[model samples]
Target: MSFIAIDRVSIQPNRRPLNDQKVAELMQSIKANGLLNPITLDQNFNLVAGLHRLTACKLLGLEQIEYRIIAYQDVDHARLAEIDENLIRNELEALERAELWLERDQILERIGLRAQSGENQYTKKGGESISPPPKTTVQLAQEAGYNKRTYQLGKQIAKNIDPEVKEVIKKTPIAKSHSTLLKIARAGSKEREQAEQAEQKAQEAKHQQKQEEMETQAKLAAEARTKLKEKQLIALQSSTAQKQAKQSIRSARTQVEKKINTTPILPGAELGDEWILGRHLIYCGDTAEDKFIGLLPSNAALAIATLSFEWNHDYLIDEAHIVAVLAREGHIQDFCARHRMPFRFEWVLGELYVGIYSQDPILKPEKPVGIEGVEGIVAYLISLYTKHDNFILTPSLGHAEVLIACERMGRICFAGDKATENVDRAIARWQKWTGQEAKKEKHCYT
Candidate 1:
């Protein structure tokens, strides 16, 4: 033991309970009878134990304190010594004691301080070293002045308690009681369960709301369809041939003749609803009649005509079917007059269907046949309309080829077929071009 400057003795990092009321009591005792035990320090003069004594000396305004310097193999050994000294000499809070015990246990294990079992070490030669068993929880608990069960419980509380609650426990003795901490832990679990239930109920409510909205929209749509069907029937019965349409066609023809006579070398094709003259106007029409028209075969033309109106109107053509075919040949006036069907136009990306009318037999153009001619027709008609401002509808299986052709030319084509094979092939072709899979569509016929 030797005297060391009071300022030279630094507190250990793991020291607990600084400036407790016990320090004043110690100071009083030292003033009366003087310090009986010297403070312990490591070679570096760091305080290892007797923190209260050191504090008392400082309070008494002592320039130096009596201390013993101990040599330690490592920091862990030093810490273990400090913890053991406090555990033996002073009463500590349950949490403080638990923390110290855990710290000491870890240090002892880390530094390989093991105890020999039974007489195993005695049987060894005098100079031989024997391995010892590790310290058990019971031993560590006992050293900390707690029974094994209380120590284990305290260990868990120290490990898992919230930081804010731990601070409260350290400051408030009542909060440090084991019962209080157990109650808080249980309450935390219940709170978490309530929060989860609330979130699940919110999700379920949102799903129910979405389902109701869809049902209401579906009902409104069904009512609208019914009203439109009733109106279409009334319109078809009162429809008659338009004398004005024949006059318009004749007037258009006269204009074409006049242009031909004036300019022997016409600069461009004359565009009509059915015919494209020079390289001029692209004529695309939709005559949803059964008559064979245009360059296609009668069967193919009729299929395409029926498909045009059917697909464009979303198979709402059942109403149109009930209305008689009000077109005929020779009476171009009456044929044109009958073109009073209210047509709704919307721009979409798809095929273009052209309409034609005739009295006797419709004249078939001597042009390319099948899909090739259809492609040519689409290309020509495309020149007549702005790309984004036009779309076509075809319901024939053969129209799939037309749709594909239009798509190839960078045109938006909407086409459907009663045949599943045609629909599948059309979807496949579109997917190939767009690199996007087409969703299955509901069809009127299928």
Candidate 2:
């Protein structure tokens, strides 16, 4: 072991984020008995392992730290070593493990340590080396203590899920679940493929550092990322698996919360009554009923409603700045004839017909957002019509997408339904997401 100045070690910028708890524990241990195992670094003084120990020493105000320097062929080789260290020593969360697995595969391929499909040690596939034999998925899976199928699925979960979604999920209970992640990754196949193609095109341009092509390449990359985001957004909203996965995550989080907080959280609100959840409000009663209507905030930003035979929410045009109704063209026309509000515009989103009505003529969207499902449509409507802290009114509690979207988007939702079961499910989902108990209002209209 050679002692080196703490400042001499350089760390990769995009390395796995540090776990504060781990660092703290290391600090306590090192403070008592000193660092027993030295960190590993490349010949160039780049960190390979013992990041937590190194960080703890730094936190303890140590100037020099013990390290072991090893030679490697290149950065990829060093990176492979670092990956091996993490995989062997650390108990990584499912998402973290999945990402490391994918990175390892890529690094192995880069260094000719990975075998391509349909090639064996005895066969020459592309004049590639097979002296020590190449590592396949089966081998890597074995190394990671997982079966081939489980490992491949883990890699797919890492590679396929939207990067943004992964970040949001990283700190949640869902990050620990491989099955839920697989379900989300499997949603919206067609859109996901398109997005992957776009991302691949953008990746191909990364190595082309030509000054002339730089500007053009940058634009292409941006466009590609935008398309990928769009596809993810669409899939996230419209896919059944996405909702189910989130529900599962919510359930898991709630259970975890239960263990920590001893005071049992009981329901405070019920059907034909209203209660506040975080900043939003929900009523377990008919939306058109005067009791529910009387509690409404006058300055709602947008109102979203589905097509119904008992449609009488046209007055929403007056209460909200924009009223959007989802129905077919003929149904919309029939409703337009009966409702007094001016039909401002109409747009087709995926398989749904959306009608826009306002007290005044509304400006058309510069670019219309297409939708393939309720989740997508609700997200789009929330984005297009509402701002932070704006009130969004929804008549139906169908899947709680509007409430979920509003909760995530910083909007206050005023939603109600005649079915108490639907209202109860919505409330439960919200409670799980926010980890706060819903209280029933004292006064109930019996």
Candidate 3:
């Protein structure tokens, strides 16, 4: 033992951190009874034991500290000596003690000191026993004043937990409690399950909404078909070629007459408000009510499949419907310009983008009539893929385009928008152009 300058000794890298209470107690003891035990240092003057005593000396501003030097074969020897000294004292927190044992085990393994079979049996070499029995991890834990299970739990928490979480735990006495870390892990799993359930419910709600829209569209298409059948029956009753020719001539003459007779019927000029188109109770001008247009699930499905297959892209009928409408009605840009409304249309070499501004008056741009090929594709795909007579249609595309596609494909179309103003205008104009008069009935709205 010799007196050495405090500045000459350095604490070991793996030394247990100084406990403030222990250091203060040691300071009080030294003040009363003087230095009782000298600190231990390695050959290079690094601390091997008595860390708290050295800290106490430093606080007392003592320049020279009593230390005894010991030669060590390697750093591992000196590290194990320091860890063993602290662990035997039973003064370290549970986590700190577990860390010491873990480090001791690693050092022993690196030095090839595992307790192999027959390791306790002395082996004579050059008339001397070469090695003592190596200590096992369980034996070390026991020696460190901890049960096997408790030591293992503490070690697991220190090894696996997030460093930030461990830092927070360090501030509390329960920092080394294995139960605390286990509870946190369980909570994380529960939160994940809750998030998944919420996402599934949201998806189900969206699907139900789409299903309702398809049903509405199907009903509308059924009504349209009924009206079309009625018109055919009327034509069949007058089936003679001569009668047909006369009917065509009369229709043409009537359209020309209406156009030439333009007395400019003002919007408010109540044109004797009793118009009925098939099952529809038609309202003219601003008094028209919104129409619920939708397709039957079966028809909606066919329309969606046709559009998706043709476009070579996956889209719900509503989304595809809009794309189809734009593609068929090539004059959308011109219509937007004439209306002086903002309509976003973007065409990138292979992609077409279109979005309508909701604030603007809806435009009923005309779409071309013939699509025999696309119609066949819808029928073929529907029959091939559907499992039942009726199939659900996803309204991922524009309803207008989907309806038109349904019509051309000889499939029933029951699709309509929530608002009827745009659709009604288009229908009225089409009816007038074809000279088809709606059935009239005397009625008045209050």
Candidate 4:
């Protein structure tokens, strides 16, 4: 151990950024107990280890500090020591750790000290160190508290990430994620290789006497490298955007499901009673029954019915201006043949059919309608058929899609379902949406 003047010690520009919190902690500890360990430095008082401790001592206004000197073969050898010291002791970010690991590996390889593959790093635990060399990659990984695969992956991240893309990544949340880094490093593999080859050719050209040609090759190489980096940036942005889109979809679905689950599903909405929800009406029985048909409004602009096993509701054509049945192709065909409704036209939406039926002649739409699943389909039909405060009729309240759509569009929904829970859910949905309670009529249609 030796003492060095605080002013004589020099820090390299490329050293890791000083951690202020760590420096503060060290200051408190050193002031309380004094520095138990000496900082490590090169012969010329260049810092090699204990950066936090050195900083603490400086802040404490210490004139000199205790340190140990290590004689290095050269600047590279000193860098290797510093990297090793940091890697072993500091809690580094993934990018920082990877950079240090790669630098250490390269320095060892350049100095002919890196151990070869299949070479024994240690014959036994606590054995003598290998002479004139370093440990194998597996051993190095183990020393770094990682498996061989993780160590190799870290090196790949350091070596493969484009510099500009790397700079962008450093400020983002994924910078600490090894898996994300690996994915980014793997993208644009072909472009990266091409850029590297171009750069190598340019370097080779520099050895010759053709100055103009060398400059041209160098410019081409630079352009290839730029394109390669741009490709990585685009790839990362696209991946991040896709991930966010999926998350948004998931979040939306989750919210819808949550509402459905939390809503009341009470039974016993009596078979022949009617309830009013603002301007909407809900019946409490099966639509196929004869008594239910008599109660139907004749002035309905459209009736939206879902396909069911009991198929006698075809008489809806006479009651409503237009009727649309949502069913599969086979079911629609079976219904058209079985019951003989108006069947004006059939519209295909993916595997589902919108069987349009009307007593009057119908005109085909000029353009195809965009689909946004079943709920959106119901909403679209409501929009096409009704004016604000006009009535819409649906036989089954299965998901209350029609009811909810009508409520939002300011159209009245005249809807019913036999299932007691279905009536309860519909009522609850309306109540939740409008922030008002529904009214059950005392009159029975029996």
Query: lDDT for each of the candidates?
Result: 0.47, 0.75, 0.47, 0.75
lDDT of 2 by residue, 1-446 (tens): 58999999999985888899999999999999999999999999999998899999999999999999889979898998999899997578899999999999988887677988876844545454335567878888999999999999999988988788777677666678787677556654555665456556555655664544555655655665555555554444334333443443344445543231444355544566777777877887778878778777899999998765467777787789999888755576677667777878777877778888888765444234234466666666776666679999988887687887787767898888877777777887777666677777745332
TM-score of each: 0.38, 0.59, 0.38, 0.52
Off by over 4 Å in 1: 112-131, 185-446
User: Candidate 3, which segments miss by more than 4 Å at Cα?
Assistant: 115-129, 176-178, 181-446
Clashing pairs in 4: none
TM-score for candidate 1, please give it: 0.38
Top TM-score model: 2
Better of 2 and 3 by TM-score: 2
For residues 1-446, write the lDDT of model 1, one tens digit per residue: 68999998888655786756889899899999999999999988888888889989998999999999889867887888888887886577666766676567667767555333343423434334555545666776677777988877776655544445555456554334565443333333333344445455545655778666555555554454443333322221111111122233344335422112231221121111222111111123232332102222122111123322222322222322111121123433443354453333211113323443222232221121221134344433332221432333343435344454344444444343344444445444444443443332121111
Range of the 10 consecutive residues with the lowest summed lDDT in candidate 1: 234-243
Model 3 lowest lDDT segment of ten: 286-295
Q: Superposing all C-alpha atoms, what RMSD in Å does each candidate have to the true structure?
A: 33.9, 9.4, 30.4, 15.4
